[model samples]
Target: MAHQVSASTLRRVLNIWPPFLFAGIRVRALSADYHHARVELRQHWYNRNFVGTHFGGSLFAMTDPFWMIMTMQALGSGYIVWDKAADIEFVKPGRGAVAAEFQLDDDVLALIRDATADGGKYLHWFATDVIDGEGDVVARIRKQVYVRRKPPRDGNG
Candidate 1:
C-alpha cells in the first residue's frame, strides 16, 4: 500500500487499471474533495452475459468500494472505515453503458462525525442507483459502512 493516491490521482489511475480497462469500466469523475464521483461501465463482449446484457458481477464491481472510499476520505485519518455489508438488486437488464453517481452530503458527514466522536462504532448505509444512458434505472446498490474514531494514545488506557 505504498501508493498513497489522492482522489484525482486515483480517478485517473483506476481508468487505466486492468480490471476496469478490460471490463470497460471508467471513472468518469472524482471530485477534488472526494465528496462525489461518477463511474460507468460499457457493455462490451467481455463484460456481457450470454443474453447480451451486462454481467451482474461487473455491475456490482463497478460500484464496489466507492462509498467506502468516499466515506473514508471524508472522515479523514483519525477514523477507521470499512465496508460492513452490501446488497444489490438488478432492477432491469443493462443493455448498454451504465453509470452511477456517488455523493457524500455535509449532513451525513456531520452525522458520522457526531456518532463517532466518542470513539464509538457506527454503521451507516448509503445507496446508489446504476442508470443507463437514457437515465433508466438498471440496478440499485446499498452498502453499509463501519466507522470508528481511533482511541487517544496518551497512555490513559
Candidate 2:
C-alpha cells in the first residue's frame, strides 16, 4: 500500500495540536509529497522562559518530529523508522519568531535506500538550523534515524 497521508493533511493536523498551537508552532510550508516542511515558533508568553526569552523546551519541540516523519513518508512502509538519537545546540536566545526547515532530497533518499537495501539496519543523520527572523542561527539540531526493511509477515525470519 502507498502512503495515504499528504503533507497538507499533516500540516493541518499539526496546526491544531497543543504542542504546535499553544506553543506557537506554525506549519508555514509543506511540500505536496512530504519531502520538505517548514515550521516556525513565534515568541509568546506561553513559550517564553522565566527570563522572557523563548523556552528551551519549546524551541526543541518546534524542531522535533519533522525528520523522522519525513523519512518515513519518503521511504514508505517497507522500512521501519525511529528517532535513534538527537542533540541541540543553542547558539542564541530566541527573542522572536524562529523557524526551521526540514528537507529530504533525492540524494538523501537514495543514500538511505542504498544503505538499507540489504535489510540491514542503517543510520542516517540529518541536521537543520533553527534561525530567528533575521536568519541568525539560534540553534542547531542533529537527528539520527534508524531505518531497516521490515521482515516478511509470514513468520519468516
Q: What TM-score, over all chains together, does every model reach?
A: 0.93, 0.93
Q: Report the Cα RMSD per candidate.
A: 2.1, 2.3
What's the distance in Å from true for residue 111, model 2? 0.8
Error of 1 at 99 (Å): 0.4
Q: 1-157 in candidate 1: lDDT tens per residue?
A: 1223598888988889888888899999998777999999989889999899999989988999888888888777888889999999999999888999998999999999999999899999999999999999999999999999977789876
Candidate 1 TM-score to native = 0.93
Over 4 Å off, model 2: 1-3, 153-157
Model 1 Cα shift for residue 137 (angstroms): 0.5
Backbone atom clashes (below 3 Å) for every candidate:
0, 0
lDDT of each: 0.89, 0.88
What range of 10 consecutive residues in model 1 has the weakest lDDT sum? Answer: 1-10
